[model samples]
Target chain A: MQGLFVVFRKELCDHFSSYRFVILFGLIAMVSFITSYMAGVHMKENLEALSKTRFSFLMLFSTPGALFSMVQFVSFFGPLIGLVLGFDSINRERAQGTLIKLVSQPIYRDAVINGKFLAGVATISILLVSIVLVISGFGLALVGVVPGIEEIWRLFIYLIISIFYISLWLGVSILFSILFKSIATSSLASVALWIFLSFFVTLGAEVAANAIAPMDRKKETKPEILIKNTRIKERVSLSSPMVLYSKATEIIINPMRKTTGSIVMMMPMEQILSSRFQNPLPLGQSVIIVFPHMTALIAITLICFAISYLVFIKQEIRT
Target chain B: MDADTIIQTVNLTKRYGKQVAVDDLNLSVKEGEIFGFLGPNGAGKTTTLLMLLGLSQPSEGSASLYGLDPLRKATEVKRLVGYLPENVGFYEDLDAIQSLEYVANLNGINKEEALGKIDKLLELVGLKNDARKKINAFSRGMRQRLGIAEVIIKDPKILFLDEPTLGLDPEGAIWFMDFIASLNRDRKITVLLSSHNLSQVQKISHRVGIMINGKMVADGSMESLAREKFGVGDKEYSLEEIYMEYFQEV
Candidate 1:
């Protein structure tokens, strides 16, 4: 535990002092604050249409009409902050010839990996929380609104889950760092995985579902095949951290969003959801709706961290 | 059971697939002795040093540091061993003091105690003035000097220096050797110096072990190896002449 803290403190300093951290901090802050400004500007246009929720302060971050809401921007690009911060964590040290000397110290190998991981997660959490508070402040200044206590509580949960999402990506990049000896190779692998998971996965899933179970309105398609196709596509999309993050954050930030998947399948026929915009679910129930997505993100993060730890301990530094 | 023997290896062999890196070897260094580990490029000096440090596992046999097996009790072994790898580096952004403080902290030394020791070490290594300078601005010789201070940070009983003088200029090399000799003489720190440079090893080492083709071809005092290779005559031979005497073939 002592060694872990020592490593963690040193690594935290490295992250903050690095240009990578500065660039990531600037990029996220700029995008998030800009999205909040845009969302606040557009919220006035659809004030009456939004319905019932007088305290829709969350909408300042989740604007429906904008090309990109702040929340959406975060859900999309936030993982890159993690990827960039951690892509070269191990390999860069190996390349610079510091790992050998580091491991030679009277410290266990596990502490090295654990300390780096904890430090990365902590840095990301701090950055995200500050950005969240900044966006909230923008909403109040631009749109003449302050979030209710309940909205603030929900936003806090949103921040926690987003950190989890980013941690998973951080774990992945660190694992790549351990697997590849060269910093360039590890970074390339991390970026390639990021692009595939964040953007192309959704497109690829849809194409794959179409091939597996074609959907044609012109010819009457079987209901089972259509359901199968949708299920396969959903399964593929769920593998991506972006999809998981987007799903969980959507419900957390927007109270009116009831279910993550099809509302028809989840609700029975007798308990009919009204055709009108339904009353928003309570904060607790909203969290219940996204609990599975949160669990999946955390699970993947732990699994990746564990694999990196084991591989690191087994690897020969001299080679 | 000899208390004077600080490092002992019995039939230590490291093989990678069909190629062997270090063949079965039996070697030992007495406490406070400077043992020069001389070998050609592929003779596995680095590999042997790594196994002794518990950084690599041997394919056969075993090694012990002060009677503790490195592979079995690495933390205990590491606590008493300080290693200076070839071309060592520090965090480029950190100054010499910060880097040394980090190393001290890693070895569980408190800052209060480490501060005084770090100062003394920097002065000894001729890096006291550059203690505030970042490692990025340091020349290769300076990093090597810093590397020495880092190696002795914990006051370890044994020192494993692999190619310690590889990049230093002649004057810098002499300075480094003098420092090592002082540490060995005053502090009784056992030194295992591995290098392909035979002359540098000849200058500081109390004994020499020559490795060729993954096996020890010669192991004894310089006089014994010289007398054996150059034939029993009252003659002084440089390490290069003795080296050619054995490796004159392929």
Candidate 2:
């Protein structure tokens, strides 16, 4: 425990002293402020142009909607922060020739990796949470209403989900740090992986599904294409956690809004409950679906951490 | 197996792919002795040091420090050992005092104790006046001195220094030699230092182990090895010449 604390303190202090924390927080703050301002402008325009109806206090419930969009934006940039913070966690020590000095101290190699992960996570968490609070405060003030218990609950869930998503990226960064020996290589590898997951993975999954289960040529004139497309869409949807979370949130937030439109325009749980059936899946079932995504996020994070630990332990550190 | 033996490596070997860095070597360093590990570049001095310090594992045999296996009981061994690598660097933005404090914290020293000792260590290493200056502003010699201060913070029973005086000026080199001598003589610290500077090693180390082509070619007291292995003659054989002679035979 003491050894772990030592590594944690060293990493944390280094983060602050090296301008890592400053740069990360500055970027997150700038991005969040911009996103909030944009959301505010859109909301103001809708109110002025559409009707004289006061901006609904219920729009504050849309904090999750804003948060969801921002979370996606944050994810795109989060990995860069993770890569920068973690890419040199070990390699720089080896390059600077401090690995021997550090390992020679009374500490386990696992402790070093754990401490680094902790520091990186802590730094990101603090910056992101601060942004969330700032956006939430400004949003509440703009909407001009006190959020109800249910709305607050949804926002809390959104915050927790975002944290898990960030953790997933952090884990990938640490894994890259362990696999590559130079800071440049590690950073590049992490960014590449981030790009693959954030963009290419979704596109690739779609292309793959289409290729494997192509539209039936014989039934091109039939309505089966629609049904096949729906199935393919659902399968492709599973490839993206962001999509799943958004779907689940929409379902729980406003089940009353329903659509017989394509599955793509399907309403969230709240709309489904109010429209399709007198009673939707009990609150518990709705939570169950949303719950697995959080679990998946956590599980992936742990797996990344486990892989990093193995690589670090087995690493020669000669570089 | 004696309690006095600070380090014992039995057939310890490290291989990078097909090339053996430290091939099947046995070595022992007793407590309170300045044991110099001498070799040319690529002769596996750093590899051997890393294995002994538990930073890298050996492919074949085993190593123990103070009766504990470095592989299995690494944390325990590390607690009692301080290592200075060939190129020592600190967080460039941190001043001397802050760097030392960071190291002290890693070594589990209490904050109050670490602060007090940081002052004393900075004074000891002649960096007290420049403690507030960032490490990037420090000269190579100053960095080396600070490195030494970091390693010795816990006053470990054993010290592993790899090329401690490699880039130092003559005066700085001499100061480092004196510091090592004092640690061994006055404080009874066991030192296992690897160096390519043969003459400096001879001056400070009681016994020197000469490695060639990943093998220990000679191991004995400085005088005995010099006289017996190199031969006593009117024309003196430098340590480099002796090293070449041994490798030539292989």
Candidate 3:
């Protein structure tokens, strides 16, 4: 326990002091700041329309800003923060010959891996919380509206999910760092995995959906075929961490979002009956809607971290 | 095993797939002795050292330090043994004091106590003036000197040095050997120095062990080994000739 704390403190200090960390933090903060600012300005212009809404304050986060919402932007770029922090965590020490010296100390082998993992998670939490608070403060100033207690609770839950989502990537990068001996190879492999999961998975989902449910060009597309296509796409894209995280955050941040699957699933008759109610979902209902997604995200994060921990403990330190 | 033995290996073996890295080797070193470990590049000297220090586990057999199994009581064994790898490295972004402080911290030394000890160790290694310099700016000799300070930061009972003088100049190498010898004498610390440089090892080692192809080929003092190979009354054989003779035989 003592050794673990020692390593954790040292790693945390190193993370904060590294130039790479500062640059990455700056990039994320600047991009997210611009995104929230745009959303705030748009909300401010349409105050009368947004005033009747249940969670108007949260629109600053869920509304489209510039090109994408703050949630969407984070889902796309947050993994980079995780990847950069962990891609070289172990391999760089091995390459520099510090690993042997470290392990030779009177400390349990697991302490090294556990300490690094905790430090990475801590850094992610710090980054996410600060970014969310800064954006919320800007939103308050621009829209002249304060978040209610329920809104605060929802935002807190959103932050937790985001942390878990990014940490999944951190665990993956740390796994690569342990498997590959060279820092360059580990980093390249991490980035490649990130790209495959983030972008290619969606494209593959489209292809898979099309192959599964072909849409004929000769006749007008049937609603049944389109519904089947949407279902297949949603199910297949769930294989990706980014998709899972985005879906979960979208529903959590926007209470108006009540479903995880296709809108076509809601029958026309049912839509007519439900259209009379413009009330947003309660906090409990929103959480229940995304429970499966949150579960999958947390499970995958734990599994990835468990694998990295095992591999690091079992690996031979020959260099 | 003798009562004074600080390190002992019983049929110690390590295998990577079908090839053996360290064979069923039986070796022991007593407390407070500078034991020279001489071997070629692929002779498994480093592998055995790693196993002894609990850094690597053997596929078969076992090793013990202070009668504690390295494989099981790893933390305890490591507390008593310090290992300096062939090419020792430090965190390049950190200065000398910071680097040593990290090592000190890992060994569970408090900041107040570590600072004072670090200052003395830095002065001993002649790195006092460069205490605030980043490791990236340090030369090879300075790194090796710092490596020594790091190894002894915990006041370990034994030292395992693998190719510690590989990159040093002749003068530097001599100085390093002398420093190690003095450390052994004054502190009563057992030293296991592995190197390919026979002259330096022959100068201070109370006894020497030669390993070849994952096996200990010869183990004895200079006088004993010379007498066993060359009959009594022959001119003193340089470790080079003895080492060559063993090399040719093997």
Candidate 4:
């Protein structure tokens, strides 16, 4: 633990001093602030539409604007911040001939990986907190409403979820760093994997859903088939880190969000509508709603961390 | 192992598939002695060093540092030793003092202690004036000098330096040698200097091990190897001749 702290402190300082953090912080801050302002504006329209005189100002974070909402933007760009910070974490040290020197210190090799992962998580945590505070503060003025206590609690939970989501990407990028020798290879491979997982997965999910449960509008008149198609489509897309994060964040930020499943056969139209349009589910319900999504992200992140740790410890430091 | 031996290896071997990197090697270095390890390219010098540092596992046999197996007790072994690799570098953005102080903290040295020790060590390495300069502005020799400071930051019981002067100019090489000699003599720090440069090794080494094709071809003092190879009372011959005699291509 002592060695971990030592490595963490130095790594955090390294991030602060490096241009990588400066550029990422600037990029995220700019895009997120812009999205927040737009979301703040859109929250006004949502309030008037819903005809709710009193709603959670926290909804501003989830309100979809002309282009994108803040949480959507976070879902899109959060991984960028994570990948950029971690793609070269270990290989860069090796290239600079510092890895041998580092391991030769009294600290265990595990300390280095632990410190690096913690530092990345810490960076993501700070970035998310700032985004939430800024957007929430700005929402108060633009939307002319104070957030409810429950909304504030949900937002805090969302922040924790956001950290885990970003850490998933950090873990992936660090895994590449250890697996590859050159920084160029690792960074390029990280970005390539990011593109595949973030963009292609969404497209592929649609294709796979169509193939698995084709509409076949001609004979498949059964409503169950359509329902199954929708569920499969949602499942395929939600498997992605982007969709999982957006799903989790959307429910947390928009307290009104109720169920994540499609229920045509299970409930009559009137009953489904009443439940869906009902007042925001209790805090516990909302948490339960997103718990699976959050767990998947956290589980994958831990798996990545585990693989990187095992490979790094067993790796030969020839130089 | 002798009572005075700080490092002991018996029948230690490492092989990559069909090729052996370090054959059944038996070596022991006593406390407070400068042991120079000389080898040609692909002679398994770096591999042997890696095994010693517990970075790579041997296919057979074992090695110990101060009676502790480095593989099982790596942190304990590392705590008592320092290593300076060839072509060592610092984070180009960090100044010398910042870099050293950062490593010192990793060694569990307190900030106040690190600050003071870093200042004096930088002076010892003749890099005191460049403490605040970014590493990018420093030359190779300056970086090597800083590498020395980083190695001794915790004042380990022994130092493992592999080609520490590999790329230095003649003057820089001399300065590095003098600095290392001072560390070994004045501080009584055990030194294991590995290099292909026979002259530098002969200058500071009390004993020498010459490795060829993953095996120790010879191990002894200069005179001992000289007499043994060419018989006693042989005419003058530098360590280079002794090396070329065993390694000559012709």
Q: Give i-RMS (Å) per prediction.
A: 1.2, 1.8, 0.8, 1.1
Tell me the lDDT of model 3 at A304.
Answer: 99
Ranking by DockQ: 3, 4, 1, 2
* Per-residue alpha-carbon lDDT of candidate 3 for residues A123-226, written as tens digits (9 for 90 to 100): 99999999999999988888888899999999999999999999999999999999998888999999999999999999999999999998888998898898
Local lDDT at A169 for model 1: 86
Best by TM-score: 3
Candidate 2 residue-wise lDDT at A274? 54
Residue-level lDDT tens digits of model 4 in A16-91: 7788888888888887778777777666666767676345576577666658877888888889988988999999
- Give the C-alpha miss distance for residue A308 in model 4, angstroms: 1.1
What is the C-alpha lDDT profile of model 3 across B1-250, one tens digit per residue? 7899978999999999999999999999999989999988989998898898777889999988899998889999888888899998789989999999988998889999999999999999999999999999999999999999999989989999999999799988998999999999999999999998899999999999999999998999999888877878749998988998888898
Worst 10-residue lDDT window, candidate 1 chain B: B241-250
* RMSD (CA, Å), each prediction: 2.1, 3.9, 1.4, 2.0
lDDT of 2: 0.74
Judged by DockQ relative to the true structure, which candidate is superior, 1 or 2? 1
The Cα local distance difference test for each model comes to 0.87, 0.74, 0.92, 0.85
lDDT tens readout by residue for model 4, B1-250? 5799988889999999999999999888999999999888888888877788888899999999899888999989888889888788678888999899878988999989999999899889999788899999999999999999998999888999989888899999989988888999888899889987788888999999988888888888889988877887748778999998877732
Candidate 3 chain A, which ten residues in sequence have the lowest lDDT sum? Answer: A269-278
Every model's TM-score: 0.95, 0.88, 0.98, 0.95
Tens-digit per-residue lDDT, A1-319, candidate 1: 8889999999999999889899889987987777777777788666667756655798887884347887788888887888988999998889889999888888887889999999999999999999988877777877777778989888889888888888988999999999998888998999899899889999999999999999997998887787788888888999888999999999998888888875423435423663354677889999998999998888988998999989999999973
In terms of lDDT, the best-performing candidate is: 3
Candidate 3 segments exceeding 4 Å error:
A220-224, A267-270
Model 4 chain A: worst 10 consecutive residues (lDDT sum):
A258-267
Which regions in candidate 1 have their CA more than 4 angstroms from the true location? Answer: A44-51, A220-222, A263-277
lDDT of 1 by residue, B201-239 (tens): 888899989888788888888999999887888679988
